[model samples]
Target: MAKAFRTVLGERLRRLGKSIWWRHCTAAAFLVASLFVLPARALDNMSFVVRGGEDELTESFRAASLLVQSWNDGLTDPQTLFAAARADYGRLVGAAYAEGFYSVVVRIEIDGREAATIEPLDAPAAMREIRVTIEPGPRFTFATARMRPYAPGTQLPPAYGDTKPAFSTAIVDAAEAGVDGWRNVGHAKARVADQSITADHSADTIDSLILLEPGPRVRFGQMTISGAERMRPERIARIAGFPTGETFDPEELDTVANRLRRTGAFRSVALQEAETLGFGDTLDVDLVVAEEALRRFGVGAELSSTEGLNLSGYWLHRNLFGGAERLRVDGAIDRIGGQGDTLGYELGARIERPATPVTDASAFVEARVGREELADITLDKIELSFGLTRVLSDTLSAEAGISYIHTRAEDVTGSFEFDMVALPVSLTWERRDNPIDARKGFYLQADVTPFYGFNMTDSGAQFKADARAYRSFGAEDRLTLAGRVQLGTVVGTSLAATSPDFLFFSGGGGTVRGQPYQSLTVPLVRPSGVTVQTGGLSFAGMSGELRAGITEKIGAVAFYDAGFVSDDAIFGGNSDWHAGAGLGLRYDTGFGPIRLDVGLPVSGTTDDGVQIYVGIGQAF
Candidate 1:
């Protein structure tokens, strides 16, 4: 069987360089002459010369030579200097070839003697002077570019021939593209069988030919699992979904790794093919997994001027019942000192089993009890939910759940109790470069919960969507512009009948930081014909930030946020809007960023004082 295609992508970047090693002849000679006077321990200078080729090519030639770069930290030992000189001979040749120079001459000398002629084991007692010269004879243009037995529709780089500058990287790229095209079509064992690359110094031209060998189309055989502790092998295989008897695809391997890693049960997953093929010409594969610790715990805290302090923690079991099942319990307490009159607390527990009912989905069950008090409303609720989450793709996922809640509310308008049964469906798509602190890419989340109310409560559906985008510009991506838009609306339910959790509020760190928490509520008439402030039926929010990097780990940002809330479910009548603007600082902690933002209301009737928010991770 032909071997699989394998090449290091970094090999292309290893060939880097710009223009000129010496300005004038006198400077070069003077430096060489003065090197003898410098103390042996104080080796100072070297004469690096590019005798021919463009300034860019010449500069690159020297930059790619180890002997030239060693001038900065002069070699104290003779053996190291001899080794570097010998290595430079081959390194400079490859560097020249990268720039299309096929016939290049590189010479390295120590004390006027050819270092390549000296044995690497021999060391000079003391070194002061060294000389490097690279003569890139001529840049070569491609004469004939050809490849045999390539997959149909595989296109080689257009610049591979005389039409444009010939880069040696183009050859490697062509081979890779050819094999990839074959692999994409189920030829998993496709490979570069043979290659003929020749150069003509007389004409300064290159004639290239590549031959690919596509082995028999193969299917995936059974996968053998190893390195698993506490996790059941059968469950590991089920979670991997290893596609036995199906045509082999490299993407399937990646999907298996992603599935195992997503469960958080494994610290690492590695895949490899068997030494011999299985029955029916199938490729047998092996999965090696390193399971994570059995138990883990973490805690976090956040502070806000209006919302007060929030402390939260969670305990998790990665493997439960010998399967890749996850069990987590979380608790939180808030409102220690803030606008609210009393504190609120919540405790929840969830259990998730991977590869349940579907290969790409997980089954989860959750139960929770909580109390929340904000503005003129207080609610105590008990809830339960059962759901299935599916990983649709690398950057997309979806969830559908049946949720039930029993709510008791006390509002300024009146007291209400509601029992609701809802079906919530949500989809999330994200492609951020970094989730903790994104520099580019976009994120989108949209969900709808349709509910049936019992016990005299009104039935309704709630719709919400959040969209965020980030763009980076300037040198080294020093600046990033981020923006977010959020919208939510409740339909089929009146403001007085909807649960407070389903309603929208337009204040606090999460909405408008400068405004008081839940301060921008809508007024609704009660049965007594008296109007009172309450959560809105419709809401819209927008946030924009300009972030600049001041240092590797420190950053600064300026931002603006605006929110709108309305009593009408359709978002038209009796609306209130508020805006806040602020400045913030970020300290990167490797995993995420620590955030500190100070904000104040800029528009609308809201709180007048500045609000300070301290938390972990980006505000968005």
Candidate 2:
């Protein structure tokens, strides 16, 4: 009985193995067939060809047509290809018209049949070829052009009303220029009322008659506020400095929007003129604002070969007291590498009130404590300060402040402690196109501070000025030349009697890169026959950079910096000058550029060789 059972089991196992082999063969055959048939069924291979035009015009038309771009990539469906080609006819015609080809003709054919004559339902199941032919007819020129009712003193462009090419874009641009001419002279409601244009096919000429309505010069009406959620509406108006009851000027509205945006209180701010004129020839203004979040925080980091890694962070409250008052706390630590005891740290807090007592004026209070260890000195300090800032104009401002400081400092000379009070004043004038990546304009900053020390029985005055200019050239202003000059001086006290932080020392990333930080100083010889560096009482520095954009997101920079530090209030023959040259790479981000700079000292001590610095924004 056992032998009979074994024979039956063997027969069943044989049948099972045969069944599995058959199924495997079927699957392999099916996969092989799909490899050949799948792609042909899924993809619609179409070729697009453009003919009958100059190379520049043909390329422009092709670039403007979505159909060409799609066909170049091989569309996957016949319906999508047909739709794109049908829409491209209008786009191509418009492109020709923009170039003054008013009588141009565009023809599209699919598989030897005109696309326009074929119905969608009758289209071939698959499109194999498409051809576009363009006949850009003789260009038309303006023969007679006239615009009426412009306000007095309106200055239109010279090209306006001239026998120039009758390009569609040119006509639209002229109309806009006419409206702007009136708007510049307080006609806030100026607009194009009507336009009559006639094309003469025989002569290939166009005649244009544009009518403008320069409504009566108006004054500014009361401003209405909208879209204020967390911020008070009254405060927004006050901060905007609405020019109510004055002649309407577009520039004033721009200024108001800029001021509100600079406060960081709003995400979006728009100043719009009312749709209808208000009473007594006045134009009512509306301020539409979107407030940002009330609280924010950020962190930043930097690296330098000489200064090591530095990290900083800040916390801010935008609407601390519901009046666009800002409160911020910030902290930073530097020098992670084993660069002696040169580690440094700082913590500070500040509160600011915008539109404090008057429009365009602000008040702030700040307190800080910090410790620094440099090659020449180590300092621990605490300070309290309060200040008032006034904005005289869009590009000018002034500030005055009072501060008290207590510091304990140690140097090669010895350890000393002092208490000092300072009255500081400063003025700033800036007209740069951009604050972070300035392409054109000038900036000037001047500061004067008088300090009195109680513990050291010393009194002195310090003055400093920093001036920078930026100019751009090349296509699209892709190249920027920026130059900076800085000068500082101290009087009424010797360097030893003044606070160490108040004195000047050259050679650092901020002064003369590639050299050690605070490395250039006045030599002081002690009785022990050892010479040590002491901070200088006077300083001057100059820097220049040529920044060129290589692409939309990448740029290159070459820079040179030179600095001088002197023991006397003015430059003396013994003053030491340090200079550095460097190349930098920049990657532009939405906020600014990320910068990496490598510098080498050209005429100074550089024991560390080449120094590299990385940070955000330009060094200045």
Candidate 3:
């Protein structure tokens, strides 16, 4: 029995060995076939040589840098760098170098390191310099731009198409215009893809093509709002951007939704779009909300030049009485050097109702007392004020209020005490260009304020206008220019001996990047060893920026800023002015441009100051 079993096992082992050998042989044959059948492509090449003068080297280096910036990878290898120069040189050949000059033989030296050389070979004395002439291509007229439905809907129709023109030489322009039209129709996520532009030089004709994809059209379906149990559903819905009969826009929806969430109304607001709708053109919406704790506490600190050695503490009630009302108490102490010292405390509250749409309003009241000692005078005052503000439109608003004040003025010689009342009215209008993705747009603003003082105090009228324009040179570069002018005049028979110390002033933080606040002010009298305060004139702040993106991430900028406070009496009328110019580096953050600008005074102050600002969104 043992012998028979051994014989069977031996036979099986021999069979297994034969099977393994066959498999190995087959794998070897497959490898050989692959090697013989595949094609061979070269990934490396020989280096080239270039040599020229310092001037030529400088120009050549600039050209090389531009080429490298445009390239996907900034090639540093000697051989690869040589190849790049050779390719660039081919484009320069026969091209006009100057009025009577042209490129001859451009070369690169790559023995140890990469260096480009340019040669401006002179023609024979008998041959006049050849000035190459350039001819403009055929002019293609712009055509009509229209938007068609991406999906069926009963909402508003798109409103941005150009009805008159007939041809568009640039497809990007047409496609962007089409998208703008969709935005007007309340479609915020609208986009154009597969863009193509065709222009026939012989026919002098053009064709613009694009595919429009309007993402989704949503509406206010249902909601479960709880944190504000004291509030009504209809009220919150209207203020939340999903008004009844209102066409859905992704941007508006996103903005208002986030605002509501930030209000600490609910622990969480879960929003989703339904899969189907009763109306073929409508989108069903659903909202699930959870309530958060009604009250909370927090504290924060920041550094600033204007406040000077300041510290603040505060406590907050997120949802006061479960009614979406916000209450906060804060205290602060400030010690300023050379200027003076101030110590004050304030209590403020914000109350709101979720149900009101256009009428929904928030009222705030604050009371404070402070003592300030300046070089010429000491001001100690107690003030109380309240205001009611409303958001009339998405970007427009108005506020009105009244205040009561008691003040005592004193100097090294004497002191006096007085009480007064103030009634103020203010109106504002703002239009944000591209609130969602602001690549190109313009913002316009106008603000007017009128105030009245009781018992021969002080009263005046103030008007301010600000306008900003933004333009993209192409996909990556942008040009932005902004100007703001503020003017105010005191006009009351009961006005006190002088204008209020809190009147509008320029030169610091927001007005000019580097100058100290109100440094532009000029005086008619030399008080406190500084300048005297002459009558005020028109205040002008103008800034211009040119930003070009070499790639999607890196960019460079050149900018100029000029500002002036033209006192009606100083320098015979419009003389006090300051101007600065400089360069900047920018990193494109998806939200907007993250900028760091290095500026130097050009004409006014002797200080070579630098300004750095970091925030979310555009500078304007």
Candidate 4:
């Protein structure tokens, strides 16, 4: 296309040179063409040459080509595209003039195809190599993070501000919160203020300013509750922990709302901020609630490698007899290998009370009848339990319960009936759910069950005590070192002992780090001439395991365990110890660590065994 235009211009120039009228017409044509070819406004700042020498012109054309390519690829809107091209070309043309290029023209091609040509009418623009200089800029950090109206009161430790302390409880404890950040001042508010960091060759440090805003010291406002009555409005409100005139908090409001929701007592709850009091910026809370079905039902099915397939269903009355109470009836059918199949049923009721905004208490009672198969024994048992549980703190809790169980077992050898009754009490304390580094967090739990015959048979008074603790050494989730040890003993006229059969065995994912299930069991085969009374249970065992996280998702563990089972310390050498080590992979699912661990026995006599266990929540 350029060659054709050049040919036409050459002929026209020749004809114009021969006649004055033609010369005038040729000049006018040149001006019109110049409008199309003149460097776009963008050429002003760019460096280029229209005509100087081969080197200069080549560089200019190259630069223009690159500029055009960028424009075509980046600019989507036509107006913007044209504007950008004009500005760029205009800069380049101006730069070339400064650099002494008398004549220059820029041609644009896209995808190896020509698109447009631009140039100055009287001069050419050429761009050579460009020199770019970049210099370091000063970095900035938070100068101060502070709160308004000054944090209330003063008993708070200075550490709270110095360390940028966050609430030990859930952030929902804040005054007012929405999806992302603070919306309104609820009951209590906290924040980081005067936060600043300093870095230098000698040291680096973070300085923080923290604030707590516990909105206006106002008493509770009139609680306005709304929702279809599943029970009674007053009853639901009380269950929500909002007993009228209680000092109001946005956090408490949310907690109450959520608890009611999880009960399935409401379809939706809208807790609104309304009617404020001037004394201290307090508001009368108006909760707009929507009730769901008072009575509901659901069915579920599950398949497992060990338990096979099972179906279960439940019918629920969320607001049984009004108040914050619930009742349900459920049933299930499960099959066992070679033990035939059995059906089971149960009815249970639970009552929940929001004793406080941050605390909850509940009581539950359940009775169940089911058949279980263990080896040659086919047993049918009826069990009943009553329990009361309360949230001691966010990461700690305790519960106590009483249970009665009756079992009748039948085998080809014979049929026997047995009953076991016991009192169970347990306490669990966890700093972090599961730590990748075992040495950083602390998890301690202890449970004891002392029992007396609800019947006779092989029954005897027994006492079992178990405790485990772990600490994380690195980040909370990454465990660096951890250990667990447990022991159980029975004492009485004819009490139950920790037999090779009855001992609390510890070897698997949650126990001695490297042994398989029941590997810790003493072999039944005994040496000749050694008449051992295998019938009698014996001393309990102690297991200790150390685990270290290698990464956020991987860890190595080493462990040791020792135990003995004898009628009454028959042999001083009866106790034996086993040790092993292995590695594990952990996936953080927020809920807890999903662990996959593989281990090998280091001391015990056992086959090459691999244990694979998968379940929800944390192993500890």
Candidate 5:
């Protein structure tokens, strides 16, 4: 059994994420210590013999033989060897029972003496050979299988009944399924009242029965808060949103936890049910919260050969007003030294109040001011917005906001000014396993902003969507395939009248990697018959990557990206497309991955020697 344990432990240790390493440490600690002791070998080799069973079953017996592991690990202590052999009997029998073999015979021999007959205190200091023999009896089938008082939607395993081997695990699963079903339907204390199990050796059959006790249905009561500092108890209770006096649903506990977690005020949250029901059969739960620090700050940077270096930083106040409000201020500077691109800078601030208006919603006000100096234009802008964002489910959210914007611009043609009011609506659905380095699942986001211009600015709507999917395969999920598609269009507006910030561009690290920043642009004929470069009205882009793991923390990637830009709402008017292919390397730091990519122009007229990009997280 130790051998099987060590094998499974080795695999699990490699597969463990940092959050779960504490679970299996106790059982393996001593054995891991033994690995460094340099103990001499008592036995040269151990033999595992099975008199009757399939090849797979025989292999299972070998794995369950602790004597085999003792020899393999080169442990010479006779008492240790004897203890391991003695313990393996129960382990082997349990393994047999798991395979529907109720009657199994197991024996271990140490130097021609039956280990079961040898006394523990009489262990020899030295031994030459150790062998184990196992005979698994005929598998049993279920002659009668039944569990009573199932809830409305209970689903039992199909193999628990007739015409199949009666696995012991199936019986346990059925019992758990029955209890969970009752809990799903408001029975908060359902349990198994009685169980009867019998085996008929002569007929090679088994009979099983389980009776469930579905305790009285219940309603939810108030939540008592604990472990909170610098946060009001009333707000914590409000965010919990427990349906006091309403029929209980088991999923509500998870919902309440998520609500508090999304506020970012708590580092950890836990709910404990009362030992006894409250008055009127109400279920009261205690909410324990460990508050996060009041303040935090972080910085990030990204570099591109053509677009230069981009650096950003932010300061956060988790509990700005003792009501789970978050205040964040951030700034960014980019285009330090690029291929014809000028410096740009942006500063923004946002304040978010959680559980405002409703438990699942938050309200926020944001303000921003920025300046950009591009190859063909120089612009400055200021904006203010207020909005409500609601969490519809674990993986979906929606937001709507109204904003006022003003901009001043100087292009090659002349100078321009615009003032606009806009309403922006967005939806996001995300199911990725890890946001920073996704291994599976998909993400989708769509936004529509309709703007009303004052005098000469264009009245139009901006439509944009980004969709990404990741699929991983092979042992330990060592290979992943990731893909992304981006689409955008501006409708009810003329190309020359649209704000430069709202227009679409396809180049730099964000679109076609190997192409120069904003190099792929549409031509706009000025009133004087001269033409200048300008952003397109419509855009489409696609990126795909195949990643292979080189080690536990290192990986390699091959990717291709292509983009299209058009002057018309659709692809009817003048259009240009470009493509770039790249190979990259990644080093995972648990929090996220360090990314490095080298790109070369694959299908574009403007080809640079090569482009290098460095950043954090995946490209998408």
Candidate 6:
């Protein structure tokens, strides 16, 4: 019985081996067939080469030629290659004209024969090479260039009538300047009436005559609003602040469009001028806006060695009341990985009304409640504030507010409760080209808040000023130098009597980063022979950074920060200085740059060897 079973098993194994061999042969045959058939159906392999031009000129010709860009992988057939080569001839000639080569010869060859001479039906079965050769003739110089009927104060470029190469771009630029000169002075209907250009191949010179018609100076008549669904038309007009009945200035139109967009209610805003002039030398402007969705929400997070992890979120309603009113609610929690009891929380809400009976002005009301436990203090606070903000210009603004705060605090000095009322006012001016990553400009802000405590005889005024400047050098602003100075002082009362929140404490991410959070403070000696940090009454901080962009999306920064916290209302003999130096890495994104900094204390009291901070945006 064993012998019979062995014979049956051997037969089954042999059958299985035969079946596997047949399947392998079938796959090999299929692969060989595919290799042979795919090539016959595939597109022809074509190569493009640009000759007769060198360096930037060669690159410019290639960039301008559509045929060069269209032949990405290869051409489908000889017919497609012929079509592409024919189109590239005109593009190459135009590119030469733009570079002051009025007389240029462009030749495209396919497989060693001119493409233009070949008939479509006689094209080769497969194309191997496409060659474009350019003969850029003698460059032309501007011999005579003139523009007529330009506004009296118009300024044209120096190359307009010089012996320099007569670039086509220069002629267009001169015409634009003539028209813009009129638009700047209230002639909104100005346009280029006629252009006469002649290129002399024999003399290697070009002559250009551009005539501009500055239509009669007009005034702004009215503004018609469109694309309003949830927002009111009247509110849109009010917020835009179009200067009606005033001389028509193109800048005013731009200002109106920018203002409407800044409200965050619109996805797009356009101001279109009437085609024909209106009666009484006036032009009616039309404002077309596409509104965005009403609600938006976002969440953000940050990490710090001393403060632990912070997480925050916000919700916004763009048109909460149909008048472009904005409402926002936000909350945050910090110190998530701390010593279990040092968690901090905050909740706040704000509502804003635009165009509050004044041009470029808004009113807002806000309320907040929070609890915080720092290194040497624990505090709980509730606050309410109402404010008016005015936009004086594109780069300047002012704000004034009244606030009430109730606080309960505990420190080494024991626990205390106080109610305070304050009147805060501030003015800010900023001219940075980019707020998130400033390359150049200056910023200045000054603030003053006077407060009165109801629980004790404490009345004082806090004054603070911040000034920053940014300057860039090198190609594409690859190197940026930024500096900032901050000054603050509390007057009219002692530090102990003032509200703890209003007092100044240095040594945190916002100040001297290498030290522990709020670790640098004035020492107060108690009767029990123990001294503790009790915050400071006056403070001054200075920071400077040298940021160098190593690549398009990568940057490195070296920074130094110094701060002083004083026991008196101003700097005195008892004041001490603390400093920190650090290097950082930045990765730029669409919204802003991701930042990581490692800081080390160079002066003052810092027990931690090194501190690290990770967040979005610049430290400033």
- Note each model's CA RMSD in angstroms: 5.8, 16.9, 18.1, 17.3, 7.0, 16.7
Model 1 C-alpha lDDT versus the unseen true structure: 0.81
State the lDDT of candidate 5 residue by residue for 98-142, as single tens digits.
Answer: 678876677777888877665444555566788887777788889
Candidate 3 at residue 580, lDDT?
67
Give a tens-digit lDDT track for model 4, residues 1-620. 22333333234222311121111223343345445543333322223233334565345444644354544464333223333443443344333322322132333222222222322232122222222111111211223222333433323333233323222111112211221132233332233222222222122212223233333444456667766565577666655666445554456666767656755677888776564574454456677877777888877543322334456788887777666466777766653221234433333444433332333666777677766443234557677888777666567777777888776765554455666676777888877444443344566666666555544444443444444556555455454445455555444423222212223334444455455433343322233433222222334545554566666655555545544333332222244455556555566555455655555666766324544444333345
Give residue 377's error in model 6 in angstroms: 2.9
Who wins the TM-score comparison?
1
Ranking by lDDT: 5, 1, 6, 2, 3, 4
What does candidate 2's lDDT look like per residue over 93-114, in tens digits?
6676667776776677777776
lDDT, residue 207, model 1? 77
Off by over 4 Å in 2: 1-54, 72-76, 119-125, 392-395, 417-420, 431-443, 452-460, 468-483, 524-532, 544-559, 582-594
**Cα-based TM-score, every candidate:** 0.91, 0.83, 0.50, 0.52, 0.88, 0.86
Model 5, stretches more than 4 Å misplaced? 1-43, 49-83, 111-129, 528-530
Off by over 4 Å in 3: 1-287, 290-316, 328-359, 368-383, 405-420, 427-445, 475-490, 493-499, 522-538, 547-559, 566-575, 581-599, 604-620
Worst 10-residue lDDT window, candidate 6? 16-25
Which model scores highest in lDDT?
A: 5
What are the lDDT figures for the candidates, one per model?
0.81, 0.79, 0.47, 0.45, 0.82, 0.79
- Show where candidate 4 strays beyond 4 Å: 1-216, 226-232, 246-275, 278-283, 288-359, 370-379, 409-416, 434-440, 457-483, 493-503, 506-516, 519-581, 584-596, 605-618
In angstroms, the error of model 6 at 413 is 4.1
Model 6, span 116-152: residue lDDT tens: 6654445455566667677777778988998898797
Tens digits of lDDT, candidate 3, 1-620:
12332233233222311111111123233334433332232223332223333455335434543234333353333323333443443333212121111223333332322223211121011211111112212223324333344444323223213332222212334455556566556654566544433433344433434567765553444444444455456545654655444676556556567656746667777666555543534555665566667666654332224334445567677666445666766665543331244443334344444323343455666676766533234567777777777766666667766777777766544554555566555666655466532446566655554555444445554456677666675443444333334344333322123333433345533556555434565443333454433324346677776766667776676777777665442223545677766776677777565655556667676243654433233345
Give the worst 10-residue stretch by lDDT in candidate 2.
16-25
